[model samples]
Target chain A: MPLRWPRRLGLVGLALPWLLPYAWMVSTSFKTLPELVAAPSAPLPSGLNLDAYAAVFEAMPVGAYLLNTTLMALAIGLLQLALALPAGYALSKLSFRGRGLAFGLVVATLLIPAQVRFVPVFTLLAEVRLTNTMTALVLPFAVSALGTFLIRQALLSVPPQLIEAARLDGAGELTIIYRLLPPLLRPSLVAAFLFSFVYHWNDYFWPLVMTTDDSVRTLPLGVALLREQGTGVRWHIVMAGNVLLSLPALLLFALTQRQLIHAAAGKAAGR
Target chain B: MKLLSPRRPTDPYLLLLPTLLILGCFFFYPLLAAGKLSLYSWDLLTPPRFVGLDNYRALWSEGLLLHSLELTLVFSLGVVTASTILGLALALLLNRPGRLAAFARASIFSAYIVSWVSVALLWLWILDADGGALNAALQRLGLPGWRWLSDPRLALPSLAAVTVWKLAGYAMILYLAGLQDVPAHLLEAAALDGAGRWQRFRHVTWPLLRPTTAFVTSTGAIASFQVFDVVRVMTQGGPMDHTNVLVYAIYEQIFLNLRVGRASALVVVFFLVLLGLTLWQLRLWLRREGAEGQSPPA
Candidate 1:
């Protein structure tokens, strides 16, 4: 097919609506207060300004939010992977008396949205005084039914002869899972990890519900707090804070774009 | 098959223990707890006193439950309908072979990958009543600007617009994958048979895309029903409760109002609604698969 200019312009027109918000976000973040007030609708800033970024840091604990978010997302991802691996392997490859029932139970859990569990879980955490702590943020999501389901689907695609050969060589189940399967399942694992990481990193509801202390707040909550300061709101500073909050996830998306898209598409196709 | 059996009868159980333990503590227990707590009235300061069915009656009589459910349904309907149609349109546009297409795909999908708070805050700035980018642009275009968020009538729609923007890209990716599965030979054959462009899509492409459409719409509905962060950040259930969806309403009942029993009742109702939706989707999916399996190949 020959490339037509009209077609190209039309495609750009379709894409512009999606892309402009991001461009505007970056542009507004770099605008000085005077420039923002003067040219609110201007697509570009006249000069680079670090003052908004500086003001965000001055107003909020950006460093602590960064650290907390990073640690929490990392821990959730690692923990979900750690739990999902063996369970998915067993559910996929191993036969047992209650295998069907166990798989059914896991699938059933998927139907129960996390919102329904928040009140009771919050009470349970508060009873033990775990609220305002990292544990409260991490515990509820330690085991991901969806992750296990995805892993199980991925594991089912592995050649049975490989696992049979390992069994013939007297390798234990754990050895096969940890050693042999990891390499073959790397894409699925990474996909699972990225989903958990991004979901939690961008998660505001859980932290908002679980932690009231500023010290324990994550990046999204921090950005929200910036807005909630109320009256004389600094649009530039708020955008700057949003930029900081969004950078890591956006960078991760850029770096792993292909794998992420493939995984998402693959999952949707029920592959 | 025998080779796949565990070394010990206990091996599978042990492998599943950690997952079961956590799910039991966090998921199963909370579900039952929510049920039991719904019957009792308690603030954080006092001992629980069981007032059986009163909480349910209160939510029903006060009319907040029905009102929030209605709001949530309207909000989700807008989000799901718009996201599905827009997503399919985007997928069809970007499904071609080119570098520009790929870049456009990435750019559109980037919105789905970021946090809701970031998206919400960005829109909050853009939709500000005065000095906002959108209003400023409107004035420049010689059109009057509307108060997007503060106005009761527009708040829910504004939130839905933000949501659709975030989600349409995601739906596009799914539809793109779905489009890939549409057999090329079938399309080529249809084209060679003198089928027009719209005819080819209507007869060949549209039928093949049903599964993807179902997946996109179902998941979109579920996510939209559970929307919280955007509503919390952008409107906080609104200037006059216009955007007060179910989850936000539940949050307010528990955290803000300290009505634990009432919130638990609301939570139970929310879970039931979600459960019904999930089962309906599952049935739709399975029925579609059944119908597809029975259909003759073109």
Candidate 2:
């Protein structure tokens, strides 16, 4: 059946609210301060200005924040992948005495909200004087229960004969994991990578608790700090910083749209 | 017994050691530490003095702890209900295979993937009292601008609204995946029986989507209870603490007041509440699935 024009219009109308803030963030970033402050509220900026973007860097150590965030995302994603791959392989493919218990413990970690661990983790880090360091930011999150679960599910779905054949060829477990599994588990690996990246990239709370200085602070915490440190309401600069902080993820998301959708659907199916 | 024996049966245990070590140190160890710390009274400066249940008692007697917990519950309820309903509606509307629908679906889902810090700031600008997009639109419609985050009464709802807007995309994606699993033949059969649209949805679609609903609601509730970034960015649990959720309260207790003991107690409570939620939802989900499995043929 041909969907009517009115229904199409309705869908677009509903979608507008979701789309507008993004447009607003971009637009407001380019707007002059007076235009932003003007009472009537112009929908678009009268002139294209690069002032706010410039000011964002000048006002704070935004470049360092961005770098720190990128590093954290990459490090955390890789670390989680490293930790999860073997564990997932073991949990799914191999027989061990504590297999069920190990799997259960990994799953149980999912139920423990990361927020509840904030104080104690912080305290532990403090005890070792690891607080306010990049290690502190990335270390606690190195192990991912969700990643373990997803990878285990992926490894389980692979035919047992593939690994069996490899084992028959005198392949060690590490060799099998390194060569055989990577290609097989590409999609779940991608999903896990994306999930961990997105989560740590946008993580504000743990970083906020752990880092006291800009040298190690990630983008989200830096942006919030930018707002708090502002003497007056500077929407343009703040919006500019928001766009800067959000752009990498948005771009990554837009580029990998199909894979992301497939990954999400796969996850939902698993659930 | 060689250390690196290739055919060793303990290979799985060896493989899982790194994960277990990290989780043990970070997750399990911290949990035990939190449990112990909850019973003591310490400000970071002083050595923790054991005061069994005093921190927990203080949390109840001081009353702000309860207030924050109540606010968290109310906030989670509002956001979960609104987001799930809106998400389901949008998913239904946009589930068809058309260019327009695809565009709309992508547009709707984009919000959820963006950073919450950015989402909070963008909405902060939109919900600004003057020159804000929302107030501006309201003014054009001849309505007076209202204090959204500034007024205590409106702060929690404003936070809830922002949360719903951000999470709608996540819920929509989940529902869309769930919708795909609903058997088309069953829907066709219901339609052939001359069932109305609402009747088909209520009886056929709704029942089929229960697992998805359970997944969505349970996860939504858990995430909402752990709400922190938006509140930290938007309100800082301010305007007379109307928007102070449990996580934010924990942060405040630990950082602002240096009440690590009380904060640890709060964390324990938060953990238990979350665990309880997961278990409760699991029970409900299992029961529903069980009932469906045992149902007589339609």
Window of ten residues with lowest summed lDDT in model 2 chain A: A262-271
| Candidate 2, A158-188: lDDT as tens digits | 8877777888998889998878899999988
Question: Model 1's CAPRI class?
Answer: medium
Q: In candidate 1, what are the lDDT values of residues B1-298, reduced to their tens digit?
A: 3327788999999999999999899989999999999999988679889999999999899888899999999999999999999999999989998888898999899899999999999999889888788898889899999999999999999999999999999999999999998999999999999999999999999999988888888889888989998999999997888888889999999989998999999999999999888887777677776643311000
Candidates in order, interface RMSD in Å: 4.8, 6.7
Best by lDDT: 1
TM-score of each: 0.96, 0.95
The candidate scoring highest on DockQ is 1
